[model samples]
Target chain A: MFLALVSGNPWLESLARLAIIAVLVPVTVIILTWVERKVIGRLQMRLGPMRVGPYGTLQGVADTIKLLTKEDVRPQTADRWVFELAPFVIVVPVFMAVVAIPFTADLFIQNLTLGVFYFVAVSGLSIVGFVMAGWGSDNKYALLGGVRAAAQLISYEIPLVMAIVAVAMLSQSLNLAVIVGAQEDTPNIAFQSLAFLIFAIAGLAELYRQPFDIPVAESEVVGGPFVEYSGIRWSMFQLGEFVNLVLISILGSLIFLGGWQWPWSVFDESVPVVAQIAMMAVKTAAFILFFMWMRASLPRLRIDQMMSFCWQLLLPFALLQIIINGLVLVYDWPNEILIPLSGAGAAGAVYLTYRAARATGVRYQPGYQTVGSVL
Target chain B: MTYEEVIFYVVAVPTVVGAIGVVTARNVVHSALFLILSLLSVAGIFILLSAEFLAIVQVLIYGGAVTILVLFAMMLTRVRDMPAALDGPQRPFAALAAGAFMVVSIFSMVSTEWPGDTNKINVISIQQIGNDLFTTWAVPFEVASLVLMVALLGAIVLARGEEGE
Candidate 1:
C-alpha cells in the first residue's frame, strides 16, 4: 500500500531528507549541549564534564539516557493533555525549521520560494508552545514564566523580523539559497550590519538565553514553564531549546555571513562539497561560540528592563535600519558606499542610544552589588 | 484516491473536527487550542491549493499570534479559573444561528458559480504580492495602517485611564 502510494524519486528523496534531519537535529542538539557547557566552563574557569567521554564529550549522551530512564512526573494540578502536548509543539517546530535552512549551497531539504519567511513564521509558533507549557502546569511560577516568555517572544520577534526584512530586501529574494547567492560580491554583514546586530541580539532574546533569560530565570521562576515537567518531557524541552540555539546560529550565518562561501574564493565552485559543508560548519560554530560567550559574560536583565530595551531601544533602531535600507535601495547605492555608511550608522545609533539613555537617567551599567544587597 | 483528494480528506476532516471542538469544548483554553488546530488545518488546505504564502501567513498570524494572544488574555483574567464562565446562557440560540449560517453558506458555495476559470490557477509569488500592495493597493494599505495606529493610540489612552492628566 505504501509502495503504491509513493513512487520512485521524490518520495525516496523526501523520506531520506526527513530521516537525515530527524537523526541529525537530535545528535546536533546533544553536541550543542556539550559545546555550550565546555565553552561556558572555560570562560568561567571550571571543568564542564570529565567523566562521560573524552573530556566529558559524551556527557550529553549520558544525560539523555538518564533523562529517559527517570520517572516522568506530572504535577497533580496540571492539565494532563495540554501538558503532554506542549513538548511536542515546542520540539516539532524547531526540527521543522531545519527544513528551510540551507546546510550548504545545494544541500537543503526543501527550497521554498519564501524560505526565510516560512522559517521565521514557523519558528514564531514555539512561543505558543512555551505559553501552553507554562499555563498547563497550573503553578504560579510557571504561569508567570510563561507569560513573561510570551511577552518577550512577541517583543523580540518584531526586531528580528524587521532585520530579516532588510536582508530580504537587499537580496531581492526570500529564498535562503538565493540570498546566499546574492552575497557573491560581499556578505550582508558589510552592508546590513545594523540589521545583523538587531537580528542576532533579538535572536538571542528570542532564544531566551542569558541577559534575556528572565523567562527561565532559575533564581526567580525555577526554570519557568518547564518547572512541572520531569524526565522525558523535561528532556524534550531542553532538546528544543538547544536545537533552537543551533537554528539561530545557522540562520545568522546564512543571512549575514556568506553561507558555504569561502571569502575571496579561497575555494571556488570547483571545490568539493565537503569543503563547502566544512565552511558552513565553521561559520555556524563561530556564531554558537559567540552565543556561549555572551551567556557566560552577561547578567540577566529584569523583566521590566528587558521589555523597555526591546520597545525603546531595539524597536526604534530596527525601524531606523529599515528606513536606511529603503533609502539605499531607492538610490541604488553600490556596496562600496553602502558598507561604510551602514557600519557608521550602526555605530552612531549605538552611541546615540547610549547618550540618550544617559540623558534620561537610564544607566547602562548593571549594579553588581545591588542584586545581592536587595536579596 | 488521487493525491490531492487524499490530502484534502486528511486536512478537511481535522479542520471540521477542530472547528466543532472549538465551540463544544468546556475549557476556554481547550477551545482556544481547538481554534489553533482549526486554523492550522485551514493552513494545510491552503497549501493543498498551492497558496503557500497565504498558508504560512495563516499559521503565523492566526495559529501563532492570535491564539496565543487569546490564551494570554484568558490566563491574565480570572476566566481560566472559572471553567463554567466559558459557557453562556444563549448556547442553543448560538448553535442554531451557526448551523443556519453554515447550511446557507455551504448551499450557496455549492449552488453558485465562482465566476472565474476554476482550472487556470494563478500561483502568485510573494514579490508580486508586495508590488501590488505598494502600487495598486497603496491607498488602502496606508489607510489600514492608519486605522491600526488609531487603535493603538486608543489602547494607550484607555490603558492610562485618568492618570494621563
Candidate 2:
C-alpha cells in the first residue's frame, strides 16, 4: 500500500514516511507515558492511573489534552527569541534522529550508510537546546538545570559513542542493517557485553532517567531545563524525551541484542516481516521496561557523583572495550576470544562500581575539620 | 537551478547570516547560539558535498561540544553582570585583525585550484577515510591526537590551579 502510494515521487514518498513517523511517535509516547506510570506504580506497590480508561490506558490521552490546552506562559524577563525557540531546538533533532532507525530490515524512513554515526551526531545537537532552555528561561533553577543537563549529556556521550564504535568495529560496518545482519549467528552482545553495559549506563544518563537524572531532580533544580515550559511547549520537551527513550532503546537493541535476527534467525529466510517486527518490539520493550524499572528502584545520584562515574568508570571501560575489539580484529583472532576479555573488563567495571559505592559515604578530610564535624 | 544548488543556497544563506550574527548579537549567549547556527549550516554544506562523515563530525564537535563549552563558561562567569561586554577599547584592533584574517583566508580559498569533479558530488566512504588515516596518514593522525592530548592536559592543569592557589 505504502509503496504504491509513494511510487514515482521521492518528495511525496519522504513526506509520507515522515507523516507516518510524526503520527506514530506521539501515539507511542502516549502509550509509553501510561505504561511508565503503571509500571512505576506497580514497583512502588500502588495503582497507577486507574481513574482514566481501562486500567488508566487513556491517562496519557487525558494528560495530552490537558497539556495542549494549557496556556503558554512566558516570563517578562526571559530572553524572548531564545525562550520561544528552545523547545524546537530540543525536540526537532530527536525526531530527525528517528529518520534512519530501522524497525525491520526494510522498514525505515531513510537508511543512510552512516546510520549509527548520524544518530549520535544528530542527538548530540539537542544538548544546545537544553542550554538554550536553561539560559532563556531567566530562572536560576532553570539555568542550573540546563547547565547540569549539558554537562551530564556531554560527558556521557563520549562513553556512549565509544561503546557504539566498538560494535561498529566488530560488525565492520556502520549501517544498521549490515550490523544486524552480521549478528545473524551470534549477537554482538556475546562478544561485546562490556560495550552493552557501557551503552546501557550511558543511554540511561542520556535519557536523564533516574539515578543519572540529577539535571531534572525534583528536590534540586525542579524539572531542569523544562522548568519554565508549559502547555504545548512543555509537551514538546516531554515528546523529545520519550522519543529519545525509544530511539536509544531501538539503537541498543539493534547494536547489541541482534535486533530482529537473534532467536528468530533459526527460521532465517522464512521469517515474515511481522515476525521480524515482533522480535524487534520485544527487545525494545525489554529495554524500555528496564529503563522504567531503574527509574522506580534507584535513588537519583548527586551531579558530582554522576559526572565522576561517567568519566572515571564508564569512559575508561568503554575505551578498553574498543581497544580489545581492535586487538582481536587486527590479530585475526577467533571471535570467541572477545568473550573472556570483554567479560573480564565487565567484571572489573562492576567491581570498581561496587567499591566506589561503598567508599562514597561521608568521610572527614584532614584540613576540613569544621565542615567534617557537622557530617 | 539544480536541486544541489537549491540545497546549497538554503544552507549557505544561514551560514552567512549566522556568521554575521555571531559578531553582531548583543548577548554573548546569542552570539554562541548564532555560532551553533553557523556551524550546523556548514554541516549542511558538508552534506551537500556528500561528506557525511565530516558533516556529522562538524555537528558533533562544533555545534555540540565547543559551543556548549562556550555557554558553560559564559554562565559560570556570570556574563550578564557586565554591560557592553563586547564593546571593549580593544574592539578596533580586534576588528582590524579579524578583517585581515578574513581577507587572507578568502584570498587563499579563491586562489587555490581545487581538484575533483565540479558537477558530480564526490562520495567518500567511511572505510576509505579509515584506511587512509591508519595507513597513508597514520603519523599525522597520531600527531594531531597527541596535540589534543597535550591541550587536554593543559586544560586540566589550568582548572586545577585554583584549588592549589
Candidate 3:
C-alpha cells in the first residue's frame, strides 16, 4: 500500500517524510518540554510557566523564539566545525529512530523487519554528538561531562538492548507492529514484566534522567557536554533530550503496554485507527508522567553506584529474563505456567539482591567506625 | 545516470573523502571523526544494497562503538583537541605500499567479472541470520565469543597489573 504511493515519485515521497519528521520532532519536543516543566512543577508544589500563553501552553514557543534571538557563543579554544555540527548530530538520529516507531497501524514513517534493531542502533549514535559537544567545547567541565555521558550511555545500553532482546524473543519478531500484534492475546507486561522493568530503568538511565544524570549534574559539571553551548545550539541539545524522553516513552508503550491494542481483547479489532492512535498516545503520556515523577522524587546517584547497578544488578536480571524466555520457548510451556514461573523468578532475583545489599551493608549503613577521619 | 549508480556515487564519494581525511587530518580527534564518517557512509552503501540489518550493525558496532572507544582512549591519553603533527618517519614508505596495493586492487577489480543476479534482491531478514548463526554456525560463533572473552580477560589483567591482581 505504501509502496504504491511512493512508486509514483520516490524522491518526492522521501522528501515529504523528511519534512514531516523535521517539523514533527521539534514540535513534539516543544510541547514535551512544557509538559515536563508543568508536571514537575506541580509535583513540587509550584505553578509552572503560568504567565506564558494560557496555562503556560505557549511557554515552549516563547522559549524557542527567545533562544533563536539570543546570540550564539563559541569558546575561543573550541573546535569550530564540530562544535557547530554537534547539535544537528544529536537531533538527527532521534528523528531517524522515529522512522521505525509504529505510531498507529498505518501511521508510521517506515516499518522495517528490523524495526527494533534500527531504533536501538540509531539511538546509540546520539552519544557521539554528546561526546563531540563536550570535546569540541574545549572546557574541562564540558570534557569531563562528555566523557561521563559517553561512559554512562555505553554502560546502560547493554541492559537496554538486553531487555529489548527479551521482548524480541517473546514476540519472535523484531518488527514493532508484529510485537504489537503478538500482544493481542495478552500484553507482554503480563509475562515479560521483568523485562519491562529492566527496559524502563535502563531507558531512564540511557536518557540520563535524575539519579542517572551524573553526566549533566548542574552542581557538579554544569550542564555536562552542553556547558559551553549557547543560544540555538544549547536549545537544540535541550530539544534532543526532550525528544529522546518522548521516544523512550513511546517505545515502552509499544513494547510492553501492547501499543494501540485494547487491553483484554476488548474492541481490539473493532476499534477505529484514530482511537487506537489515541490509546498509544495516552499510554505514552502515562510513561512521560512516570518519568517526571521519578525525576522529582529520586536523588542523583554516584557515578560508581550507577555503573555497578547497571553491570551488577540490571545485567544479571536481564540475562535471567532471557534465559527464562529461552526455556519457555524451547519447552513450549503454556502461558499459564510460564508467566507465574517467570514472575517467581523475578521475585526471587529481587529478594536475592536485597539480601546481598544487606550483607554488604549498602541497604542499611552501619554506625560510624572511624578509621582515617579528617580529624 | 541510473538511480543505483547515482546513489552509489553519492555514498562512495563521502566514504572515499572520509578515508582520505582520516589519513591526512592533523588532529587525532578529527581523524577519529573522519573514521566515523567513513564507516557511516559504508553503512549507507549497505543500505543502498538493501542490507538494512548489516547497515544498522555497522552503525552500531563500528560507527558507534569502535569510534567512540577510539576517541575515549585518545581523550584519556590527553591528546584530544591538541594540535599534534601526525606526520611520521614512515610516511613515504607507507604511501608507496598503499599506492601499490590500491593499484593492484583496482587491476583485480577490473579484471574480475562479477557474478550478477538479475533477479530482484530479496532482503535476508535478521531472523534467518540469527537462526543460521545458532544452528548451522553454532560452533564457530561460540568460538568467536570465547576469543572475545579471552581478549576481555587479557585487557582486565593487563590493566590491573601486578599488585592489583
Candidate 4:
C-alpha cells in the first residue's frame, strides 16, 4: 500500500517511510507513558492518573497538551545553540536506530545488512547529547549529571556490545532478519542465556533506569542533564528516552526471544504476517514490562557500585560467553553443550553477585566509600 | 550532478566546516562538539563509499567514545579558563607542520592507484572482513589488540596512582 502510494520514487518512498515512523513513534511514546505510570502505580500499590480519560488513558494526551503550551525556558547563561540543539542530537539517533529495526521479517523502514551494528553505533551518539545538555545548561547539577551519564553509558556500552556480539556470533550474522530467522527452531536465549542476562543488565544501564540511573538520581542530581530543560524541550528528552526504551525492548526481542518466530517452529511453514507481528509485539511488551517492574522495585545503585558491576562482573562474563561460543563453534561441538556451559556461566555470575553483595554489606547503608572496599 | 554526488557534497560541506570550526571555535566544548560533527560527516562519507563496517566503527569509536572521553575530561577540569589556549607562541610552528602534513596527505591521495569504479558501490560483508583479519592479517590484528591492552593497563595505572597514596 505504501509503495503503491509513493509510486517508484526512492526519495518519496524514503520520506513516506520516515513520515510513518514520525507518527508511529510519538503515539507509541504517549501510550507507553500512560502504561508506565499505571504499571508503576500498580507496583507501588497506588492509583496512577485516574482523572484524564477512561482509566486515565488520555493522561498522556493531557500531559502532551500541557507541555506543548508551556513556556520554553532557557537560562540566560546557557549556551544558545548547544542548549537548543541538544534535544535533537539526543532524539534523532534513537529514531535513526528505528529505521534499521525490523518488526516482522518484511516490516522495517530500511533493513541494513549491518542492522545490529548500526543500531549500537547510532545509539552511542546520544552520549554526546547528554554532555551537551549538561554543559550548555551552565548548571552544576546538570554538568555533574551529564558527566555521570557519559561515564555510565560508555562503561556499560562494552558489556552490551559484547553480548550483542555473542548473539551475532551464535547466529553467524549481523542482519536482524537473518538473526531472527536463525532462531526459528531455538531462540538464541536457549544457548545464550548468559548473554541475554548481560544484555538486560547493560540495557538497564543504557536506559539509565533504576539501579543504574545514578546519572539522573532524583535525590542527588535532580533530573541530571535535563534539570534546566522545560516545556516542549523537556518533552523532547522524555520522548527520546521512552522511544529508546521501546527500541531496546524491540531489539532484545528480535535478537534473543526469537522475534516474529514462533517457539519450536510449530507451524513448520511461514507464519502469517499478522501472527509474526503479534509475536514481535508480545516479546517487546514483555521486555518493556520487565523494565518497568525493575524500575518500581529496584533501588538505585551508587555510582561506584554501578561502574564496578559493569566492569568487574558484567564485562568479564560477557567476554567469557563470547570465548565459550568461540570454542564451541571452532570445535564443532554439539549445540546442546552450549546449554550447560552457558547455564553454568549464568550460575557463576549469580554466585559472584551474591558474594559481592555480602562482601560490601550493601544492606541499609548509604554513604561514600572506597571503590576497592565495595568491589 | 548525480544523486550520490549531491549527497556527498551535502555531507562533505559539513565535514569541512566542522573541521574548521574545531580549530576556530573559541570555546573548548564547542570545539569538541564540532569535532564530533566532523567525525560523523566522515562516517557519512564512508557510508557513501559502502564501507558500512568502517562507517559504524568510525561513529562508534571516534564520534561516540573518543569525543565523549574528551568531553568528560573537559567537565572534570577548568575548561572555561582556557578560552585562548589554541592561540599561543607556537602558532607559526603549528601552522608550518599542519601545512606540510596537508600537502603530504593530498599528494599521497592523488598519487595512489585506487581500486574499483568511482561510481559503483562495493558492499563488503563483515564475515569476510572477520575471516581475513583472523587468517591473513592475524599478526597485525593480534599486535593491534596487544597495543590496546597495554594502553588500557597504562590508563588504569595512571588513574590509580601510587598505591599507598
TM-score-based ranking, best first? 2, 4, 1, 3
RMSD of 1: 4.4
For residue B126, give model 3's deviation from the true position in Å: 2.5
Better model by TM-score: candidate 1 vs candidate 4: 4
- Per-residue accuracy of model 4 over A29-143 as CA lDDT, tens digit each: 9999999999999999999999988999999999999999999999999999999999999999999999999899887888888999999999999999999999999999999
Instruction: In model 4, state the lDDT of residue A206.
Output: 97
**How far off is model 4, as Cα RMSD?**
2.5
How good is the docking of model 1, by CAPRI class? acceptable
lDDT of 1 by residue, A1-375 (tens): 556454467968788788989988889888888888899999999998899989998999998899999999888889989989999999988888888888987788999899999998899888889988999999989999999999999889999999999899888999999999998768899988888888888989988999889999999999999899999999999999999989999999999998887788775456579998998999999998988899999888778778877877777878877788788789987657767776876897678556744554334454322211111
TM-score of chain B of each: 0.85, 0.91, 0.85, 0.91
Residue pairs clashing, model 3: none
Q: For each model in turn, which proportion of the native inter-chain contacts is also found?
A: 0.57, 0.70, 0.51, 0.86
lDDT of 2 by residue, B1-165 (tens): 988789999999999999999988878889999999999999999888788899999998998899999999898877877757769799899989999999999999999998856767668889999999999999999999999999999997786675456
- Please list the residue runs of candidate 4 whose C-alpha ends up more than 4 Å from where it truly belongs after superposition: A1-7, A266-268, A360-370, A373-375, B110-121, B162-165
Per-residue lDDT over B88-151 for candidate 4, one digit per residue giving the tens place of the 0 to 100 score = 9999999999999999999999999988576666677888999899999999999999999999
Instruction: Tell me the number of clashing residue pairs for each predicted model.
Output: 0, 0, 0, 0
Model 4 residue B124 lDDT score: 76
lDDT string for model 3 (A246-268, tens) is 99999999999999988766673
What TM-score fits each model?
Answer: 0.93, 0.96, 0.92, 0.95
Docking level of model 2: medium
